[model samples]
Target: MLLPRPLLTLAALVAALAAPSVMAIPGAVVTTPQVRAELVAHAPEGLGPGRPMALGLLIRHQPGWHTYWKNPGDSGLPTTFAWTLPEGASAGDIRWPTPRRLPVGPLMNFGYDGTLLLPVPLTVAEGFKGERLDVTLHAEWLVCKEVCIPESGDFALSLPREQATAGQAEAFAAAEAAKPVPATGAQARARIDGQAVVVEVKGLPADWQGAALDVLPATAGALRNAAVPQASWSGAVWTARLEIDPQHTESPPALDLVLVRDGVPAGLEINAPVSGSWPAPADAATPAEPAATPAAPPADTSLGLALALAFGGGLLLNLMPCVFPVLSLKVLGFAAHAHDRAKLLAGGLAYTAGVVVSFVALAGLLLALRAGGEQLGWGFQLQQPGVVAALAALFTLIGLNLAGVFEFGSVLPSSWAAARARHPLVDSLLTGVLAVAVASPCTAPFMGASLGVAVTLPAPQALTIFAALGLGMAAPYLLASAWPRLAGALPRPGVWMAHFKVLMAFPMFATVVWLVWVLGQQAGIDGAAALLALLVALAFAAWAFGSRSLGVRARTGFGLLSLALFGATLAWALPAWREAPPAATAAAAETGWQPWSAERVAQALAEGKPVFVDFTAAWCVTCQVNKRTTLAREEVLAEFRARGVVLLRADWTRRDAAITAELARLGRSGVPVYALYAPGGGAPRVLSEILSPAEVRAMLAELPAVAAPA
Candidate 1:
């Protein structure tokens, strides 16, 4: 039966007014096959003004299904309670009890099963602003067994100032008994004992040899959740050992743990303050210490390891696509000084110096920009259209010279034929600089964590990391020049040098083409066309200047024309590039990927659907390659479809604050980050930048066997 708009509105208002008491019922409370949940206040006499009250949430789960804790160990989401309080009302933090470690094969989880009462404090203002309190809480939690379901509910209740015995005080009492007891006069410290982080506690019960001791870290992600935590009690002291997580980059200054004894509350939750240096990852010469002695340093924060990783990443960058054009330069430099040992060594050193200097300068600039509140990452310069266009022009000129279309002056005093050996420091230094300029657009696998930590570290340490990367990048050239044997292995310089040199020009041109495509993405089609026309004028200028017959006046005229064409191109291109097209994220438009937003991710998670996030940029060669070779495959598409996964791409080609924050949250500082979140309660599993279909298949196979949404 359909009614007129006004009549329907009036009827709804009447129905709502008639059933005001229905709000007291748990109609909007969430109930699933595995669990049922509700919200209840602990104020037996209705909440009074300026009084402290408690709220208890009753959650009951079917056998084998459970909800997570404040620290959900390995891979699970903590339960969340969001409230919309009436004026002058506030809610305190959730009081969490000690959780039991639930082992699932290789992974471990911390949570509660069966029935539980979760309590929180509700504080009313000193002077009540209103006659009644309209309290509303939105609860969201993940319930799981073999499969997990994300659920939420809206609950509201009204409390009048007049004291009324209407709240669940009994439930609150039960929760208080279940809560972990806070311990005083207790001091604890952590130390490295063999392969484990051992914590020793003082001021516990004497002769408590048989009582159980639990050391649970309040800081999630600091320790390995799957490892069985070992505990021992001796001589009125208790000791517990935990294995540190290898991937944890930063450590909390203080660790808080809830202690339990023999399935009973120890009345001793302690905040352990750190006072010692970090331990080495490798086994120290010192033997494993007794549990009572917790003075040995704990897991170390790696600086040398980070530097080594950075260097390795830089070495691998030479083979990445972005560095291909520079390879040709290296080849020419090599052939020119193949027989001169001193010149070769000098050139290599100069090149190495240039790379190191440039890397330091870039790192300084990046840090300065970050301090000034710019949301950016590595290869950020390429995000600017001006930088892209300038690089394109430089590559085009270099390509023309290599193709023999024009003759720039010799890199050394020797002529183009390289018949005589001569080396100039400026030329070698410039080669290193050019290599860095091109290499900035690419990020190899091992670079991520090193770069991520570099930004967060102090200035001097950060510079060291960047310097290490530069040294690695220059290793190949340095080795060839310093070691005559390596250089001697190359084929002797010959008449074929010209042919090889000319062939190298095509790669430079290809680099120019790629830059133009990137420009097109930054700008639009019209802007790209203008840039192409400008390139034509540039080519003409080069040809005119190189001509044997052209006089000075004619060359000058061509140069003027090129200058005018470039001016016109910039007039149109600059403005257009600044005006970016509506982005469909870093993923290409045809891949059916949606642009990422925190809201979108939250919404998808609330729906209990799986999500795959691709954090990438157009400047990242690895990102594009991975997209083409792995993520775009039909098999991957079928897998996604079968699992009902929502795909999102966080485009980092430009400055996106949210995306940068997300990257930092994931402990990454560069593009090509892939995160796969399963429908079950757990932290997202990160994938390698250089993705493989087999890895993706294996990741999917490990997920719980939940039925796909229809």
Candidate 2:
């Protein structure tokens, strides 16, 4: 026996109701009607003939529950309604009344908590005077208290033509006209400040509170979403922080501010203008500074202080974690040639020259990038996968060599080695290049500031600064070689020298490990694995090439095979590595946190929740140390949970454009940037790069006191 059509439809509806509905509104938990208004359709009781029938969305809410307006502040979905009307009848968009700002905790939600009327205007076609009008509506809305719940209802209303009235139509139309026109008269402004572009807005309403205002950048990827706009009020003026996209080199034509106040849209526009001067070309002579602060300093007292500092800094770099491994080999060389001051000095000078030359080259590259309107900074080279891959390969080779897999003792061309062996000057120049390569990782304390100025200054000034850094890096070697007596005071070479060589190998191996890790960050696990395989193959080839019994042709073939593998690895790995998605570096299991994204942060903030952002990188030792020692502690996790803080980690292991832009906005170019936001009013407090238990406690303590439990 077949079921009737209506019965079948009812059965289908029952099945559909049995399954959970997929909601467009996220995080909503409870939804109920606040108020319900009845409408009699097609009735001429209130309106004249030929007028469209109307209905009122009588919205009623459970006490303390609320639904959203068109512009859901910070994070709620706007109420939407779809109508199914009979033929020759049409309904206009929902007419929203002005909404109120509701602060739940730290977040500001745009909505209404009590009963309200949302008038929907319906039109009937001319010459159609119906006795009865039928209308259906599918209404979806988000209702919230602490958490939000989405709800929808299918509603139908019927009215007799005799009951329809014009007064009712006029009343609904008038209510809609009174709904606030999207707030206008506001505008945005932006300016370039070094690496960051600072954007500000003006003409916001004077009576506005923090919970009532929100600013959204119109351009995708032009601004970092994690950046919290710092809001300040001075009399009638409003100022807020807007960090520009650090990756943006050219000035954007215009900035669109999607400002919302209490669920109402306040559209604003601002134009960005280019202002800063460009660096001089590499070949150009350095320009003179103003007489007030002359480039040429007072000559008598410390003629070469900058150069000496650079050289000293370079020498100290041999002790830096990154440079120590490479420096150990040079130390061995020094021990071997301890008796020959000429050879030591010659090699030292050559190394110094190499360091200077490389620095000059780096400066030139920076200048070139600036001239082309590319925004770049120190460590920018490392951002390139090709550069990172090459470094990885170099470190791997060095590690293998140190492990006694092969000898680079004769790796240099015989002609060049012979010349260097005969001329100390040549040896020193080559040593300088080695020194610079080893020192690449340790951009010591004063280095960043100097480099920043160099990249922005004229050619001569930049070169001079570069020379100073190179000189500092090479100074220790130069100093040892310069004073033979001091060198002689060093312990005599013996079997201990062999032990020292092996010990030195560890540093090179350590460097290899660091490089591999960096590669993993840049290329993902797959890319890292491929590169590692290439290194192992190269090690095998070196072993084969060095075998005394192997025929020349066979050895040559093995070497060529290794080269091919390395080349193939480079070709396949570079682009894939560059495009790898960033993974969270911080151990979030302890904090029950996830990697941060703009959308997630925005959503959380919109819902009136406090947020904590941890910006960290895998390669940064300090960041790791802090994570393990302080941040990951159970006590800290408990505190975060107790406070209801939304934990977000912005990982910067690789060159993440979003992370970089965020850093730039915070007046920083490197991790770790820790920020804590209060519920609504207080400005966020930025934690120190090197976090401590006490510091974290102090910062957390500083947060505005949470309301006492009821």
Say which candidate scores most in lDDT.
1
Positional deviation of 558 in candidate 1, in angstroms?
A: 2.6
Instruction: Pick the TM-score winner.
Output: 1
lDDT of 2 by residue, 1-710 (tens): 11122333687667644533211121112233443433323234533335544566656677877777665544456777788777777788776665666654333445676666677666767655666565666776766654444455656654444443443444465455545553356555665554444555566565553444555543443443334566665555556666543332324445544555553433333343434432221221111100011133333323345445455555565566766665665677788878888878777777777778987787677678757845444455655656656666676666666566666544556786677667756645655565565455355333432343354456776677677777777677788877898889878889887666666767766766776777677667877776677667667766666655567888789878877876676565655664453333333444477776433454565566767888776555556667889888989877776666788887665554445444443434445668775544333556766578888777666554446579
Q: Write the per-residue lDDT of candidate 1 for residues 1-710, one digit (tens) a residue.
A: 11112333687667755652323533436566777887777665556655557765789889988888898765557888898887778888898756777765445678889887788888887677575677778887867665444566667766655555344566667667778776656668876544456787878655344576666667775676666678886766777878766444336666677776665632357776655554433321111110011112221465677889889988998888888788778888788788888988998999999888888888889889888977677778888877887888889988998888877642223364353324477778888888898796585465887777778777888889899999999998899899999888777788888898999999999998988887776666765676677677777777776654667887788768767876666666666665555433235465657776544554466577778888877778888888899888999877876777888887776556557756765667788889875543445677877799999888887655457668
RMSD of each: 16.0, 17.9
Off by over 4 Å in 1: 1-301, 410-423, 583-588, 678-682, 705-710
| lDDT of model 2 at position 357 | 94
Q: Taking the candidates one at a time, how many backbone clashes does each contain?
A: 4, 50
10 residues in a row with least lDDT, candidate 2: 284-293
The Cα local distance difference test for each model comes to 0.72, 0.58
